[model samples]
Target chain A: MNRDTLAAREPLLLGAPAPVLAGGGAALALVLAAAAALLGRRELAAPGLEIVALVVLAVAGVAAVLLASPFRAPFTAGAHAAVLGLVLLAVVLDAAAQDGRNAVVADDWGPMVLPVFLLVLATLRPPREVLLGGVLAAAASSAAVAALSPEPLRGVAAVLTGVLPPAIAATALGATTLRALRRGGARAVTRSDAASVQEEAVARLEAEAIPLLAAVEDAGTITAAQAERARAIAAGLRAALVADLARGWLADAGFRVDDPDGYAERMTAAQRTALRTTVASLPLADFERPGLASVRGQDRDAVLELALPVAARPRRTRVAPLVPLLRSAFARADVRIGDEQVSVRVELTVPR
Target chain B: MSDAVWTPRFALSDGLRAAGLWYGGTALALALASAALVVGDLRAVAVLAVPVAVIAAGGLLLVLPLPRPVAVAAATVVMTAGATAALVVLARSAAPPASTAAFPLPPLKIAMLAFGVNAGRRRAPLIAGVAITAVTETAAGLVGPALGVPWAFDLPATAGLALVALASSGFLVGGRRTAVARRASRTAAEQDVLARTRAIARSRAAAVVHDTVLGDLAALAAIGAGPLPPAAAARVRSTLDLLASPGWADPAAPPDAVGGPVLAAIARAEDPDFSVRLDGELAALRGLDGAVEGALAAAIEQCLTNARIHAGVEGADVTVLADRDGLTVMVADAGAGFDPDAVDPDRLGLSTAVVARVEAVGGSVRVFARPGVGTTVLLAVPKAAGP
Candidate 1:
């Protein structure tokens, strides 16, 4: 899988996990900031709380923009609290500067930062986080205003104006976004599965049926040998595709396969897929023979043992290419062959 | 890294890329700004000229039309070191001419800091450069206050701000390259796997044609010459049955092996007087790869062919021994046995088909026999299940 595919696994935040949306949201905020800066071009009469407030807002804005990137380290739980801390500090500074003329919460531009802080977090966090986080943030903002402002009533009302819009936006939009993400992931999986099914069907056609079809197309006459060849190819195709017998090993394992005793979890998804493919390819059942080959091993150990009965020759040529793949995946591979009175024994052990 | 050095298209491209210019340029600009920020120290500012020029020249080389690897490295090293040394002299030697100092860093100190932004280096190297600058500037902080050095300086703020710029720029350059390198390696490994798969498929087709088509054609020739004999007919039927199996081309293990398991294959193929023996858990063979299993079966088939044609005996012994590492098969016949080494090298029966096939699957083979004694052929393979 590529980086894009790995990123696709993440849940969409507020319906904007894609690059265009992620970039657009931050760009929209930046453009708005620029517009606000242009509209209210007030000269700084003095630099005290105003400078501190600007600096805090700038830092918060940069953080917001960086957080908006689709590819990012996962945001932590305390991250929202950190944003709240910045707001707390900014609100305290703004309030201290007002000196009782009016609540700092009621200051012309002081309280505007609350919503921006919330939006930054809402767009980055999961839906449940947005829900719980929005409440905590609103309460904290109100508390900051209440504790710091001399006019508690006016302060609460002003803080509410700052917090409510973004809080609602984060909750409703966040839920919808998560739902869409879930739907997208499921749809992608379904499409991929369908494609594989079609591919397998096409491969079967090419491998078994096509040879006979090509022969018939090329030669009008069908000889007995050719007819026999077609029938054999058909049977071979069936044998390759379907195994009717139950494996003796599966019965021995005591049906403790669902959890796999930590073995399944320990392996990477790719390794697990490879294991399944290898096992499925092995000829576990033969109509003419009762027991030919089998695999038996525990997950704790790296080596997986394969016991194959030999007659005239061992099945080494067919098994050789997989050796490099196995060695790359596992720790070691060893093959041993022995002879008995009527049959031969071929054994292979691969450890990881 | 070696590819960047060797390939003409990639050579020095990372260092010379248009994106790399900003790093060196920013460092040089910061150095110049530091020199400009001095309050009333013309002497200190004058002293900044030499190191500032060096930093500018180095930064220019970094951003030039095509930056060379050797030149870029030399520039970064010389400029950073030279600027730090110049700042140290300004800090320790200058006298405090005024009581009030508005700027945090003197011109020389600022230049040292500007040079500290080694963006080509990652976090560790960038931080080290900044640390060295901070240490060098501490001479001013320690001596200026104690001995009334002429110029005023604020080491803490200057150090902190310089660290941030240097660190951030360094991280940006290093992190991006690291990500690109990781992606490149993954793609190369995947491509190798794809190529190997294609090769295996081709070789498997060849094996299939050799085993089935050629055999059938030769049988057909017999039928064309005269009526097909019973044995010939049986042979044709057997060939057809093999062709009808899935993974017929080169199956390590046949998905639909006729008659279930190894026991059945042996029972059907063995002569009346032949015997069988099994050792170890049969379950161990459960998940063997089809190709590996197919090789084992084919080798066994070859051994039986050799025995029937050359052994001149009705009875043979087959014994299977499974171990922790793998399993082994031994085919022994008590008949007119010949020296193994005496077999014609041109005859590709036991040597090429059986031995080579078994060995290919990471298995081993041993043949032991003497005149008037029994012959024993052993084959073994090892494998692991990959998810």
Candidate 2:
């Protein structure tokens, strides 16, 4: 159920597939138009308009790719408008380039190709937005032909045949798809959460202690080794519980820092584990003052600084092994052994 | 164990339906476009375009993500406009019959299909067919005398479209029903597993308490009327420390030995005051289910305690038998025994503690006892089936 819903798979839907569909549709439309122009070059009265229309459509195609890019954020209404507007302009230009030739309307790729772009638009935005844009584009292109052509009735009829049906069909199909996704997302099963935390803890403890108890039972008496192992396990279990009860390991480890916003929660389990291990590896005397830590905001990043006393003079080799681990956890990890103090600084990308 | 393992019932169907819609809708649109192109009379094609454009615009209204009532009303207005345009075109003496007949079919049917798909946003596609039938019938009636040429409504074709709509809706509904049932059954299974797990954990926790804190208390009682011995005092202090420690519930390393649960139960029940002797194939309990082991251990401990307290016996014998069907455990004692039927059902001894605990793990319990004859409790549990 985690990735079953449309909302969960939104990234996948918008990722490679969106761009492929949009780019592919735009490319095919452009290719067909270019091929038609070449095949009917002699029939084209205003070749200048045709050349300008092709260039305009090429721009729209590029814009479509950009809008559909998975790397970019969800496109806005303004971006949708701008791209569709460009396509519409090129369409009118393509029609005008036919020089009022009624027989050539079906051959004009503008109306024929417009629906493909509309379908591409459907991929990036909501169904309602795409439908609105498609309708406006269809109406304007159809009206332009009806007004500019010498044979107004044939012009309108041709534009209707090429544009309206496909555009309407695409809208119906796109809307159905979008509506299904929305309904699916709404009904997706909820995932297990903190409700299982207690069970998990109890199960972990049972797993550890059951064998020792069984061994003791088999021998009919507790050995010194077994007693010692039991005591050690108890101590370890105690430490873990204390850390959990106190909210985190940092406080129990004797480190001090002010994080009122609780940004540390954003760190994954691996990152937190690395930080705990790295700090635990260092000697208490190495710090400027034992168990002291500091945090400062540096623009968009949070900088955590741990200072070591100059007299401690921890060797470079002592810190070298830990740099990679800290670096892996954070984007920037700096360990400087200056004359005044040996300090470690880590830069964390502050979550919005 | 992860939520990713399960998939909802309708997850695939919704997508397939969408794909079908696109394929069907696109094919219809293309066919209409092709027909318009094939026709030679440009003058008639122009007149035919009116109804087609009107229908296309009306059909597109179904694509809007609007409330059901609003969409229906909007579609009505646009569809009515389209019918009016169709009427005007049919009435014209110059309009060709071929162009007029083909013009309204594609766009009107697509609109009808769209309505079927988007009806009430989630209604069955049959609703769209029903609504389209009414509209088409009305249009045919109004245009029946188009310049003395009676226009006919195609009922069979409309019925076919309705059947298509009904089939699509049935597929969606059937898939949704199957998914819901699957999800419910899986959820129930998961909850049952979780309950068994929780029971096992509780049993383990109880065993630990008996081993440590209760053992220390017994040791203290044994050293009566004097200052506690060094070892005993140390043990008491360690128990206190453990009780007060924050990580008391921390995860422990898993036990290495199999059959540990049963062995541990026998050991915990083997008190100086109450001895327990184990016999039979104890090794057979190895690799058994944790729940079965925990339940058996808890039940055996209770039985031993009962023999010591009520039966006035110093020791008991435990026998374990294992075969293909399952494992059976019997704890017998020879001493003063009371009739099991005479015991109150509410008593938290043999009935609640032993019987309920064993039965919880898909096992059964049989208690045999009579006054002065001693008592024997038999517990049978099935093997742990492979995952």
Candidate 3:
């Protein structure tokens, strides 16, 4: 699994469908507008045309609400397109009702409503998909106007110039920004060394083990005390070996924890790395309380807490960039900037 | 191991903010330019400038770290009111029909798109879009006749800009999703590496103990407390040498470079009545990491002991299998079996001796048995630590 998959899964699996937000808003607006037209507050050339337009707008509002509902499977691109199509059809009907009242175009509502709907719909898709949808919508609307207007070319020009720029520009701008960020993030990823981790693990144990063993070899024979010492060393070695087997990057990086059950070991690689980097970024002198990092496991959930120094407490700007990675790695993360210290608490759920 | 975690380079929300600013600013500029050309009177331009300035202030809010829905709503309302007021001023100034036809509608549509795209949550963008669209359309319909502009609203322009906003928002969401997936996969791969590296470390540590501490203790036990014998001294010196060697810690060094702990355990576990019929991929055991070897050896011995002491059987079967991932050992005994779960929690036989040992090397233990059925213990160990 990837970071995107993990993060996306939370929202995609649990959150309301993407289109629902736009659909609700659209329904409210359409309903109000339909009510106004029915109340004779707005003028339509024909009474029948006015009713038909209102009915179409009401249908569009209902369609938007239906689109917002959860599907058994993924809500596909076709579904989004269909909903957008219905809204556009409402726009066409509304415009047609106002056709005779205007000199050149039907009314401003047709021009304004479609783009707003498209803008909301675009949020549900990718840049490319949005581009295709935008282009298609613009082209279809232009064609419809051109077919109806005496000045067909002028009508098409109007649509292409006035309707299309905002969506296209948004796609271009967003895509550019994302690419730049990805490029920078790639460099950060490249800096981690895997082999050094092994070296670090080996070094941690070698310090205590080598001196004791060498003294035994040099003594040549075991005295009552030496034999006793050897037995003690053996026991220590066994305990250390078992403990070391369960050790993770947290202990390796010098974070203190009362983790007798080795709950720290259950942390995913991303969590370890992110915590390591974030801790490294904080100046040691700024630490509010030394060795304040800990992981407490309750059932399958592990809650990790770290205390940032008093000096770092006010520097939220510096910590902001690091927060996203931490949040992404853990199931839930809260960073509280307090007067005494900056406290970061993260919770993650491990598999049984 | 490749990297601790994969992180998105940039935030999608920030990108949307930038886009909002760009689109909003662009629309404002266009509106200002159109008002300048249409209303030649400097006084009319100055009058239009008041609302334009307010719209600019509203656009600034989009980039601020304020609540997104609130910011977008505030900005959209400001733009709508400002644009409407400016159009009204143009109408009073008697701006030409063609100049009045387009004046603020297209630019306002773009500005509205900007607000909607930056709204940050569901329905807000649509609501912002619809609200702005309604105001602009209403303003245009009322102001168009006053100015005698043939077409007050640009329908195609509105539709086009709406599609653009939709596409942009979609792009942002897609980027965010991609970043999340990348981070998750990296996390998974890193976990795999962590486990393998742990197993490898466990193996190395076991080797160190097997050769140094275990050997020294055994020798001391056998010789008693005394001055060293020449042979014993040499053995002690050799153990010291082994501990001091940097190669012992090097992952590339074969774990069996010193001694095969798994073989030793097998030899120690065996007796005449409780023979182990060792079979299948025996050669693969030679390549086992020291941790895996030590754990497997101890666990196997414990299983055999359990079989001999408990099972009313003559012999047991031991099968070792190797695959791309690692090794799997099946120790089966046709004897008196008991429910694994019902086994005393304090009994070190299965939990500590077998389960703990196997798990230490990033391996798993599965004990399958029933009252009348045979017991089978399956131990699986990975070859290396990571993805």
Candidate 4:
């Protein structure tokens, strides 16, 4: 399945709470525990204190699962905090469970803790600092648990079994995820930079081309070879524009079009054909004829009356066949026909 | 790859020293921990100590800046040996039968595989180091339980995690290098384009200043000194007026509009210096673009100006060549010559302006001057190739 579809399905399957909620619960629990210890007497019921801790831990676990859900924002400070809280709650419960205390342990903590850390490390945006801090905290906490337990040797063994591997794994995963992100970012920046340089080069070439063409035309003796060179320069400009258009089209399709040269030849041919067909249809008979006429005849013999349909309206049906012939003639000779003149002239056509 | 290089030797010495110190410390720690456990008869603690000693040693090896390939090989051997010894001892332990299960297959194999794979990578140091750590941890975790040893089984997961960390670090380093290279290349390209553009601009400016001002002044000076004729003074003044007016000087002015005045000025500049002749119809050339005409006229004037100033001897020749390709104005002096290279066009008053105007129309200037042989300045300009 595609990432978006998979992401959509994530929360439904997991029924996870949002990371922010879990983080809030954990923070509240910590504050309450500290307040209870300091404000209330030591004789206060241990069961009551344990019950509160369990509720807070459960809330934090739920928050962690929600934050880890595929639909959650990949990189956020709140998500990291929530994941960290989940791990801490797991550690506390694991310690409690080992002591045969039924009041606070959760069945899912063993399965959830490592995975939550992994999810946080993987999805967290800019995971470097937070991941490092989390790993360090976990390692230190494990060491503390080993050192402070009543059965020091067994406690150290428990810490090693429960804490070291998971923390190290989380650290490794976090570092890898951060590297992948950094590499991907670097690749994107490089590509954009290359594209910009190419664009600038094309712009410079275009700016130079216009003045150069003008100067060549002004010289009044442009060779066929020089004209071809000018056309090549124009082709380069057309290719650049086509590439830009294709990029926009591809971006809309959710893909980036990277290779301009790959599609250039086809685009150029299509554009050239379109331009040729458009130019071929334009009438040019008026330009062929001069504004003034000069005729030399010896004494106008017999006063010949020639009624050459000067104002006859051309048949529109003749336009299609006549256009090609007219284009050919105009190509060889300078044609300056106006629209009004074409309308009033004799119609010319050829069979299809 | 070259044996002659200084870098390779330096890297080798540094790596060897670091590896020796790390390994020695690890061996000493292991010896001390073993002695403590044996004396106290703490079998459980002894099992833990062995793995801990091995791990500490491995970590120390990685922390040092040893060559990656060498480190990977060393780590693989050390981990394999440590695992074997822990397995043998754990099998004979007093733990229950279930606790003494055989080591899992894949995880142990993967650890060994990682060692070889990591050592083969291009960035060997980072890849191998992480791989060794990962494999060793995995092997320890799986093998420890089977032998009834207390070795930690978290290493495989830890190694996998380390792989991720190392990969990210590599990316950051590679990204920085790529950015630096890209910037350097861009800077070089920009500098090249700028240099070419500046050279073109400087040449054009020199030509324009010479044609309009210095040429007129020199002709007037000649006529005032009375070399030959009285009619020359009138011609000089008319030429001066055309030069002073905006009509001829401004690029936007019409060619035919300034034609009459320019032709009069040219006549004045030419008549007093030599017996002059004008060929080619001025009216026929009038239909051309104004900028083209102006460039052509200015180039011609500069050539004449050069002939008068530097020719030094009598009867210098002035030729105006024009075609569809553009115009060429040649001024040849039958006078004592000077080196063209040695003569700074700016100081000579004619060379700089003549070269600039000709090149402004995508043309060139050739100065052939030698002592006792006289000089020839040929300026060829194309009409369509403009500034």
Candidate 5:
């Protein structure tokens, strides 16, 4: 996609924010350092290595926080890996300080730190990044444990069995959270688009109608040209009324129509008159009269059909006074007539 | 969404919800403890009884109408009684006395009272349910010693305590239901008033449409007229258009939204000089409804118009504020404020339209001004009673 399309999509979701990721990364590092310090309080067998690890973690966390705004592109994916790599190095150093004793770093406290890396990385990055981060967590765990253990092969196997679940579970949770947020953002965008459309329509109506209403109220008299202008304005208002009705029906998505044709039959006598009156009140020439007419939309149906009858001649009734009103008021029309019938049946579908 | 011609759902009392959660959670905890206690005993014929009663308790809560759970209530009582009989036999068969009464409170009695009292619409069911629970707990305690199983409480004391506890819980629940029922009835009465007001408004709207729209059409169609003056003809057409369209066709009512009442009131209170500025968190206000809003809007429009014509301001400044409980709009203008007391008592505009309109819907309007200072009409309307 081009820059314009990218900009458009980013406005709603605004692709992986760096500050949040950075803050979350620093928080994880603090928690890990705190956990290590608490666990080591009993006895820091390798005091110099533990101090170096703790110092490195603080510097990296400070860098992550201070540089979050500038480090937007690829740095987001490596947040956890950076934090964990420092911890792993410290562990390796501590083990080395023990004269090749792996147990000093390979103990329960060190390996338990692997899951926190998984959680932080999974939560901060997108799905693909999370998947990659999980892979790195597992690999790092296996390598760290093996280097610190007497039996390297057994350490690799143990890390795979015990540490892998947290890595995978955290990754899945992060991916799901990312998916839900994206979906919600898309829904908001869709609603905003619809609202803007409605707003535009309302705006247009006011622009055209406001001046004309003001002119009528001001002049208190109509010239032939003004009458012609009023005729055009009246036509727009007529279309607006029908469109508003159709839009209302559309807004009610679960609306249903159990019996399509019977919908017209279901209208009360007064309702039927009101329906015709609503349409007939529009301004149009005599030639535009509909030959037949029927009432539409009353249930949950998306399509609001106002059936108008087309006549053989210019025979007019209360409903079929203007055929053009039905045409302008509806989105689509379905017409049917028998050979001997007085007028053809035209079912106009009002647009949502 | 609201119209006089349609019938909506009957109101659900909030007491029913609290009662359900309280009873359902209570029964579940009791059922689990009872099941764990008796699980290892091989002689438990009715080990399934306590668990089934828990399921029945959930079922009772699930029913929509609280009074209509008779079948579920009957099923529960039978299950509890059977469980009590089985537990008694097992306890009698056991060697230890303390083990026979180790359970905290009577599980069967608690389940029966909770579910049975839940289904009560009147006082009889409550009384009978409590009695059954007390009697059964007493029976279980009394029979324990005969079979060499010593119970925790003396039979009489156990029975008396059970009766007191069950009766208290039942009566308390019933009282909650009564209060909820009162609220529901009040809501219904308000709904009835709302429907009647809508009907009257609809008729008034139809009459206006008939008088102005059809009347203009007749004037246009008359053959006796030589020619319509431009002003006269223009008036007819514009008037007809407004009268016939959806905006005017709709009997205006309060919409749910913080600015909705003010905006709707603004829409109908159409004047060239009347302008509006709205503020506050609007998301929660959308559920507010009915003629009360329309009335408030119309009143605001009236205030703005009154300011323009009487107070000598170019246009009125309207500020809308919405908070948790209700909405308020302040229409202020730096114009010649008047001695409100000196105004003619017969002037019907403010008294009839602004004051009366808001009052009808249980709202208030305050007008403040001085000789040189501007006028500020503070129009405040509480949210209409609803969910």
Candidate 6:
């Protein structure tokens, strides 16, 4: 349903175990034969080699199963080549066994080989799928050998011994792979949840910080003690914001419980830039117009506008929304310029 | 009273001690296991026996009070040594006959080198532990045959190989866990600091609001109950205007004009002749705020009040000067001045309140006077990073 769940499910459903099982079998045979030769029992080496060739053929069967897996783009032609090599080796081994150099050739081997080939073709060539396919192939081959062998009971025992270990291992491998995928999916969900919480916290902090700052501005004449308190408060707010930002950044980046200084620094820079641009874009009234210019000269209005660009901006546009809040914060104040004076208005802007 | 009580025994110190003990016990167990292996009884019983005894001892130690770092270090060292020895034995046993002469070097030396480097670097000890485990496994593969161990290094021996693989995987998992734990701890600490800071800021903002706006509003309400005297009403009006002024928001305006009305209102409380001078272009003092103006006005008024009360002066001269660099205000009186050194900043009167007020706005105030000579107060205010 979720991205992570999909990631987990897709991998498991599409994973083919046949390749891994067949490859593992081939590798085991090769390694055993190589070891037998290296150990210097020359006469017994041929049977080992024949086994190696058969294992290679089994590997090709596994490859075919792997190709059947969903999303088999990653498994290339080289994998197919490896499977073909296995078939060639199996043929060579069968020929050598017939020559009686040193081969353990069972009479009803064709039926055993056919099931392996069919099993390989049924599953796609993903390692997990291939492993599963190999197990099935081994099972089928063992059953066929038991049914067709002259000593049916002995054949059954032999087949069971030969196929059971690999089958159990293949199944175990598939289970482990599936478990890992599920765990990964769960972890991804947890991370996303954490990230969402962090983001919500950050947004809350930002919303809180702006109002707090505005309140500080509204607080009438600050004493030395009050200023110190304000400084402390500012520092505290900054720290809180930093923490929230760090958490959010880490969560978004999928950093579970890790130091996010590097990420936070980058995010803070971007936030600061956004804040600055917002501030700069805010429409502030410009009131520095020359006092007598509008009355004194024909071009005086333009001159006044040029001189006090900020003051010349329409007051309507520069309307302060937080004026009432600020008014409640400070005492009434007056100034005397000659005999006539106007009142000072304080306004605060609450950042959203 | 309960909050003030200092109970030392129930503190974080005990927890730290417990942590240490736990680590120490773990170290001792690891050491014993390694020692047992080094003594070389290659029995399955020995493999199971030594580790179990060590773990039990470690678990017991954990309950005892001890320093955490010491316990952890000790445990880490012991585990490292034990793990290293195990790998060494495994590697030696697994070596091919032809490669047996170089047996110990490949597995044992590599593990030792990794452990030593990691210890020196003071990185994740768990990673070192895993390397040691891997090396020991390799060694076991080489030497197991010579030692006549039942397990042989050969194909079709999936059970034996799987066990080794599982151990190696465990090592990797342990390393990752350690890394994650360390990272989590650091993030938590940093987050705590940040949370504390934010709380402090919020408290400060609340305090500031209480002192400024709330105080002013209360004063306004009190004055509004009755018809204010004519002079007082004018002063109140001016004060209200100043409070509402846009210039108060500017961070670079002169203190006097910025909040002049508020102080003028306060001065009107006692003296009807109280007045403010705005000598320079008001536009030039663009960044002044309400607080700085209030402080400046209060300081001048305080000086005047002091002169009238202490020096028997009739009136004081107040002059405000604004320039590109800064603003200066001189409040001089014909009243007699006292010794500057005699004034304590903590004193209740003008020296403490007025001088402090001026300074709070990034300004300096100086009083000069002699016996029978008028005292003059010179105040200089700067306009930067202040209200």
Query: Which is the leading candidate under TM-score?
Result: 3
To one decimal place, how large is model 6's interface RMSD in Å?
Answer: 22.0
Residue-level lDDT of model 2, residues B1-387, one tens digit each, is: 145532332433344345334533553455345445544545655665666566556655665667656766566567656655654554452543332223334334544454445444235445655666566656655664554545554422343353334334433443342342233334433443343333233333434454565565345334434444567656655655554444332212111112566767666676657766555544356547877788888888888778877888888888877755678899999988777767855336887789888888888899888899999989887765222
Q: Provide the clash count, candidate 3.
A: 42
Runs off by more than 4 Å, candidate 3: A1-75, A96-108, A148-158, A187-219, A223-352, B1-10, B17-95, B98-105, B108-387
Q: Using lDDT as the measure, name the better of candidate 1 and candidate 6.
A: 1
| Candidate 6 residue-wise lDDT, B1-387, digit = tens | 246532211221222223223223322333334323332444632553453343334333323445544543444444444433443344444221222222111222222222221221123333433444444445545554455443333222222232223223322332232342223323433443343233222322332223343343334334433333454334434534443343232211111222335334333434534333223222223345667666766776676667666666656666656654466777776766666667544325666777788787788887787767877788776754254
Better of 3 and 6 by lDDT: 3
Candidate 5 local Cα displacement, residue B213, angstroms: 15
lDDT of each: 0.43, 0.56, 0.58, 0.38, 0.44, 0.37
lDDT of 1: 0.43
Ranking, TM-score, top scorer first: 3, 2, 1, 4, 5, 6
Model 4, residue A290: what's the lDDT? 12
Docking class of 4: incorrect
For DockQ, the strongest prediction is 3
User: Model 5 over residues B236-312: C-alpha lDDT tens digits?
Assistant: 66674664354332323211122345555554444545444333323223334667567777887788667767776
Poorest 10 consecutive residues by lDDT, candidate 3 chain B:
B250-259
DockQ of each: 0.01, 0.02, 0.11, 0.02, 0.01, 0.01
Model 6 vs. true fold: TM: 0.25
DockQ of 2: 0.02
Backbone clashes counted, model 1: 117
Against the hidden true structure, what lDDT does model 3 obtain? 0.58
Which of the predicted structures, 1 or 2, would earn the higher DockQ when compared with the native? 2
Which is the better candidate, 4 or 5, if ranked by DockQ?
Answer: 4
The chain A TM-scores for the candidates, taken one by one, are 0.46, 0.59, 0.51, 0.34, 0.42, 0.31
For residues A85-187, what per-residue lDDT tens digits would candidate 2 score against the true structure?
Answer: 9999998888778775635454466654676676566545665666678778868887887767765655565556546544555455455554555565443
Candidate 4, residues A192-232, lDDT tens digits: the string is 12223323433444464434434443443344554455455
